[model samples]
Target: MAKGHRSQIARLRNENKDTRPSAKVSYARVSVTKACFVLDAIRGKDVTTALGILAYNNRYASSVIYKLLKSAVANAENNNGLKADDLYVAECFANKGPTMKRIHPRAQGRAYRIEKRTSHITVVLDEKK
Candidate 1:
């Protein structure tokens, strides 16, 4: 039983064994749905091409994602010793974060709940094989 538990722990630790460099932006002031729109455009694209798309995109989320992508590329080059020219976006995603709640005053002493959504974004880059 002890041997089985130890093996399971080892496997769990190795689950994220990928050497690709990644960057994350937590609690960004953007909704997950909005961020996903930008993330979808960059996935599987070369670093240069992805930057081009992000640079020209008009969405507000694109601006935030653009910075995050650049950080990931820099991480790959400096930390992972990978070439920026050969890097591609292996994965990009945005997850929902805690929402800030506020009350809006309405007519007749009524109050309306307002939610400001936030997201956590991650970008992973890998070298072309």
Candidate 2:
């Protein structure tokens, strides 16, 4: 049991030691599925191309993701001393967040529950090999 704990600790430490610059947008007013559509398009894509795609994409989530991608690139350049041109999106994903419960009035004095979903999106940028 002690040996198992040691390995688990090592794994946790390694996971927390990522050097790539990343940015996260939490509690974004978008569903995970909608955010994933935009994130999928930019995963493994270069920063410039990803920016262009986000700029012209019609999805509502794209606008939120565009700001996030820019922030990640800025983090890489300013904090990590990396060139924006040399960076690519190494990882991008969206996770489900809390839902805002709302009530919609209906006929006969009834009310319908509405759930406005939210998501937490993250983008990690790394230098090209």
Candidate 3:
């Protein structure tokens, strides 16, 4: 096999063997910009702290993301046999989703275009070292 192929195989072999499971929420009603605000707050926070932050957040998107976080935590516990206290926000991000276009009635028989936004959110938990 080529050197590049050998390296790729080795990389995969060295990856974490833990069975930690993650959950994703796609096409959420929240916008990417709004979701990013919540993600930033919990990027490096511990599981407990992150939950606290989400609980107190007044933003609309926080509710949705908090539910996703809980789901991921449950996945890690039930699927991977990991403890909630040992998990952290390893990776969390929101990407822009498809825009739904609609027309609004306007004066002079003209229509105004409106774009409703959506977001794709993902949460990944890892076992703390």
Candidate 4:
């Protein structure tokens, strides 16, 4: 209510706002679109259920994502001092990263350009509030 106390309230709000742990895997050799396919299936789901979804996914990105998700859940439990069962995959997504350019040999003394795509994937989990 007082001027000096307003800053304290703000700090408390920030501390209480989703202090769960997260993990990020950057420069993954996968495109954002491909990663999103797997992320879209697990977003807003419990940790166990999200892992289940990742396990059965046929996409190649799922393997990497599954490990990242597990890391996030572990972080929540160990670092953030939160229970794994109380957390869920609040957010998961991938963004395009740097592209590697290469030249491929072609017929008639020509060259073909190759763009190797990369992505930065992040998984954020939070306790159900």
Candidate 5:
């Protein structure tokens, strides 16, 4: 805690904040590995190309990521005052979320645990420099 006024400290924090536009989906039903497959395809591609890839991809995660990517693009355009054409997928990844455990009954009275995994997926976009 350095000596500074409250407003000044807030200003300093704002200066260090990441200005890039991004979107995240929490507790997405898809697993990290599956989401990463879609994320990997569009990680560095331009927004238009990324959308195109997402549009035609057959993976379930692609549909979720596609909507998330669209939201990120809208954020870049509206919130960041950036043009859609100049934006690209700068960074994107998925993180593990809470795992929901379910019980599967086996033969007799044996119980087996089944994990319904969830993930938090994020897509960060930046303007092409």
Candidate 6:
């Protein structure tokens, strides 16, 4: 249990919040492994180079992450008042989200469970010091 009132807890939580600009896509219809392949490419790269990598990559997750990266860059510029040129991907990851289960009928009327996995992808951007 928390040791503070509701308002106090809210204020304390807000104080420790991450200040770097970022963007997240919840319930993205891509698996964590696939998304990590894209995230690994741009983890520490500058925004322009990261975008370039995403632009040419042929992976499906790259497309989703491409738009997400752009949104993060825009967030840094508009919300954080930071220059896009100075920003790099500080942290980018995909966490597991809810899995949608589907039934796949097999031989002898056997039903197999097919899981359609989803992920929550996040891209955090920070200015180079």
What is the TM-score of each predicted model, taking all chains together? 0.89, 0.89, 0.84, 0.84, 0.91, 0.92
lDDT of 2 by residue, 6-114 (tens): 8798997888898999999999999999999999999999999999999999999999999999999999988999999999999999999999999999999999999
lDDT of 4 by residue, 8-66 (tens): 88987788786658999999999899999999999999999999999998899999999
Clashing pairs in 5: none
- Give lDDT: candidate 5, residue 99: 96
Error of 5 at 126 (Å): 0.7
Off by over 4 Å in 1: 1-16
Model 6 TM-score on a 0 to 1 scale? 0.92
Best by lDDT: 2
Q: For each candidate in the order shown, give its overall lDDT on alpha carbons.
A: 0.93, 0.96, 0.89, 0.91, 0.95, 0.95
lDDT of 6: 0.95
- Show where candidate 2 strays beyond 4 Å: 1-16
Question: Tens digits of per-residue lDDT for model 5 on 18-44?
Answer: 989999999999999999999999999
**Native RMSD of candidate 3 (Å):** 3.5
lDDT of model 3, residue 42: 95
Tens digits of per-residue lDDT, candidate 6, 1-129, equal 779789999999999999999999999999999999889988999999999999999999999999999999888989989999999999999999999999999999999999999999999998999
Off by over 4 Å in 4: 1-18
Off by over 4 Å in 6: 1-6
Runs in model 5 deviating more than 4 A are 1-9
Clashing pairs in 4: none
C-alpha lDDT of residue 75 in model 3? 90
Candidate 3: stretches off by over 4 Å: 1-19
